[model samples]
Structure formats: structure tokens, C-alpha cells
Target: MLTAAIGTWKLVTGRADKLFAGASEERLYTELAPGKNRLIYLWGHLTAVHDRMLPLLGLGPRLHPELDAIFLTAPDKTVAELPSTADLTSAWAGVNAALLAGFDSLTPAQWLERHADVSPEDFAREPHRNRLAILLNRTNHTSFHLGQAVLAPK
Candidate 1:
């Protein structure tokens, strides 16, 4: 199950990375909708969310905690200053590379262990809140955003 989950995550994130890699910096500024998140925002948002998963999974500390305020906490276009697409692009690669390494190091038993945020008591009661669950949820999240992101280059 863990293998399958990680494979699916790799598939979706690879699609997202390819889309961003092929996109021109100017092209990423276009919004998915008239007032919805721009492709740039989605890139940073996904990077931020994945970076956080490092710590949540006890893989390691976040490579870019600062991204939370701009991409995670605040909505699109709300923050006056945002990182350059190039920077976020680099960060996206870095975070995912780190996560892949961490994921590779963990055993299937480790994946079934509780994530960092869940209390021992809670984890005992809610075994579903394991590390593998985070990967599944984030995989779906990335796939959802990737579906929207594909509209940008069109």
C-alpha cells in the first residue's frame, strides 16, 4: 500500500513539475480563473505544503518554513510581495527531492506509524492518522491543483 501510495504521489508531482518547468515565467502569472489562484500561486502553495510534510512525517524540518505566510496562510493576490517564479520553482524541486529521499529511507512500518502532529492517545484511537495517510491526502491535493494548473498553458 505504501509503495502504491508513493508511486501515485510521484506521478502527480511529476506532472506538476513538468508543467511548471515548461511554463515561461510570464505565462505563470495568468490566473486559473478570472479571480482564482494564479499558476504561480499554485506552485508556491504546493511547495509550501510539501515542505511542511517533511516535519509532519518526522522526515526532517521544513526547507522553507517562510513560505507558509505567503503561500499557505494568505490567499492568492492577498500578499503584496511574493517570491519569483524561478525561486519557487527551485524550492519546489528542492522540497520534493528532500521528501523523496526521506520517503525512501522509511520502512513500510514507519509509514504506518503516527505522524508528528497526532498525539499518542489520539493516534491510538485513530490509527488512520498515520504517516501514509498524509502522503495520500497530499497526493490528492497535488492532483487537484495540477488539474487546475494545466489550464494555464492553454
Candidate 2:
């Protein structure tokens, strides 16, 4: 199950890399629909969320905590001065690289251990709130954004 989950995550993120590579900088700014998030916003949002997974999984500190306010907490276009496409692209790569390394370091038993966010007591009762569960959730979240991002107007 761990192997399958990690493989699925890599497959989805690989598709995301291809999608982002194909999109032009200007096109990334265009919204998927009226009042919807832009492709660039989705990209940054994924990067930000994935960065948070580091600490949550006890992998390491967040590499881009600043992105939380811009991409995680705030709505799209609400915050001005978003990071440049080049910078965000770099961050996306960096975060994923770190996550890959961390994931590789963990044993299957470690993956089953409780993550950082859930309280020990709650986790004791709901043993499903583990690092692997968080990874699965984030993987699904990334896929959802990737689907939406693909619909962004030309």
C-alpha cells in the first residue's frame, strides 16, 4: 500500500510538472473561469501546501513558509506581489525534491506513525491520521488542482 501510494503520488506530480512546463507565463495568469483561481495561483497553492507537508510529516521545516499567506490562506488575486513564475517554479521543484528525499528515508512503519498536526490523544483514538494518510490527502488535493488548472483559458 505504501509503495502504491508513493508511486501514485510520483505519477500525479510528474503530470503536474509536464503541465506547468507546457503553460506559458501569460496563460498561467488567466483564470480557469469567471471568479475562479488562475493557473499560476493553483501552482503556487500546490507548492505552498506541499511545503507544509514537510513539517506535518516530521520531514523538515517548511521551505517556503511565506507562501502560506499568499497562496495557502488568502484567496486568489487578493494578495498582490506574488512570487515570480520563475521563483515559484523553482520552489515547486525544491519542495518536491525535499519531500522525495524525506519519503525515501521513512520506513513503512514510520509512515504509519501519527503526523505532527493531529494531537496524540486524538491520534491514539483515530489511528488513521498518519503520515501516509496526509500524503494520500495531499496527493488527491494536487490532482484536483491539476484538473482545474488544465481548464484554464488559453
Candidate 3:
């Protein structure tokens, strides 16, 4: 399970890394059409969520708590200011590094354990909702948003 989980993560992150490897700060704000979210928002949102996952899995704290307001939980098109692309990139990379490190510490048992907000009793009742499940859900979400990124005009 560990091997499979890490392998899946590697593939997904690899694809994401390639996609954003050449993304400039200016390009990060490009949208597929008017009123759509900027690429930076999506990227920052991804970073923020990944940061959240760390603590959810009993890993560590969020690298950018400040982003939670703008990236996580905030409704789309909500009027607000955002951080610079470079700052977000730093947070994104740092969170991913810490997440990978945390993954290395988890055994298969840990993967099956309950995640944040979901109590042990609830996790027992909903067997499918575990730490690994959270990762799977987040990974799927990232892939979905990646499609949006691909469609945005370069």
C-alpha cells in the first residue's frame, strides 16, 4: 500500500510539476475566459489544500495559514487580495516536501487510520474514509483542476 500510494503521488506530482515548470507569474493569472479563476488561484489553492492535508494526517501544521482565507474555503469570485505567485510557489514546494516526508513515516496501518475532523468512531463506521482516502480524494481533485489548467490559454 505504501509503495502504491507513493507511486501514485509521484506520478501526479510529476505531471503537475511539468505543467507548471515553465509557468510565469504573469501567466499564472491567465484565465480560459473572462471571470474564470486565475491559474495562480488554482495553484495556490492546491498548495493550501496540500498543506491542510499534512495536519489532517497528523503530519504537521500548514506552511501558509494566511492563504487559507484566499485559497481555501473562500467562494469563487469573492472579492479579496492574493499573494504574489512567487510566494505561493515557495509555500507549495515546502508543503509538498513536508508531505512526502510525512508519507515516509507512515506504515500501512497508519494509512488506514482516521484522518482529521473524522473521528475514530466515524472512520470505523465509514471504513473507506481514512488518511489514504483523503489523499486519493485530494489527488483526484488536483487532477480535475489540472485539466482546467490545460484548457487555459497559454
Candidate 4:
């Protein structure tokens, strides 16, 4: 189970790394259309989601404030200033490293324990899912948005 969690995190982080690698500085902040979503906004939201969700899996908070700043915006807001590709890329690498470390430290019994903090009512129906499920959800969410960021217009 812990292996699965590590694999999922690696896969999602690799996708995010690829998305940022080919993008230019101009592309980082470019929106698909006027007042639409941009690469930075997508990356920022991913960071915010990670910040909020990863702690439930026993990972530490995000290390970068710029990434955390994305959480300040309401969910309805679309337009946002993007961090430079260099900065975004650096932060992503750091986050990936930290998450990998966390995953490495988890034991099989730890993975199976029901996280006390996550409410099933808050998410779907029940609150008894294991840590691995939460981690998988987060990985999927990050991958989904990373794909959107990659396809976003410059």
C-alpha cells in the first residue's frame, strides 16, 4: 500500500515536471483566453490542493509561500498572476522530494489506519477510508490539473 502511494506521487510529480519543462516564461502565465485559466493558476491550485490534502497523509506543509498564495483565491476566481516557470519548477521539485520522503517513511499498518481528520461527509459519504485512498485522490487531482496546465494556451 505504501509502495502504491509512492508510485502515485512519483507519477503525478513527473507529469507536473514535464508540463513545466517545455513551457517558456511567457507560457507560464498565458491564459487560454482573456479572463480564463492560465498555467500558473493551474500550478498554484495544485500546490494549494497539495498543501491542504497531503497533511492528512502525514506529509508536512508546503515549503513555498508563492505556491501557498494560490490558496488565498476563491475557487471561482480564474485570472491570477503566475509564478515564473523557474520558480514553479523549483517548488514542484521540492514538493515532490518532500512527498517522496513522507511516502518512504510510511509503514503498511500506517497506510491502513483510518485518518481521523478526513471526513467522509466532507468528501462523499463515509469517513472510514484509509490513508492510501486519500493519497490516491490527491495524486489523481494533481495529475488532472497538471494535464490542464500543459494544454493551456500561451
TM-scores for all candidates: the values are: 0.96, 0.97, 0.91, 0.74
lDDT of 1: 0.91
lDDT assessment of candidate 2: 0.92
Give the range of the ten consecutive residues with the poorest summed lDDT in model 2: 17-26
| CA RMSD of all predictions | 1.1, 0.9, 1.6, 3.8
Tens digits of per-residue lDDT for model 4 on 60-154?
Answer: 65576555545445542533555666776676666666767777787887776666485656535553487777788788888777766756765
What does the lDDT read for residue 99 in candidate 3?
90
**Model 2 per-residue lDDT at 111:** 98
lDDT of 3 by residue, 72-116 (tens): 788556846787666766888888899999989988988988888
Better-scoring candidate (lDDT), 1 or 2: 2
Instruction: Rate residue 55 of model 2 by lDDT.
Output: 95
- Reference-based lDDT, each prediction: 0.91, 0.92, 0.81, 0.67
Top lDDT hit = 2
Scored by TM-score, the top model is: 2
Clashing pairs in model 4, backbone N/Cα/C closer than 3 A: 120-126
lDDT of 2 by residue, 1-154 (tens): 8889999999999999888756898998899999888888889899999999999999999999999999989999999899998899899999999999999999999999999999999999999999999999999998998889888877
Clashing pairs in 2: none
The TM-score ranking, best first, is: 2, 1, 3, 4
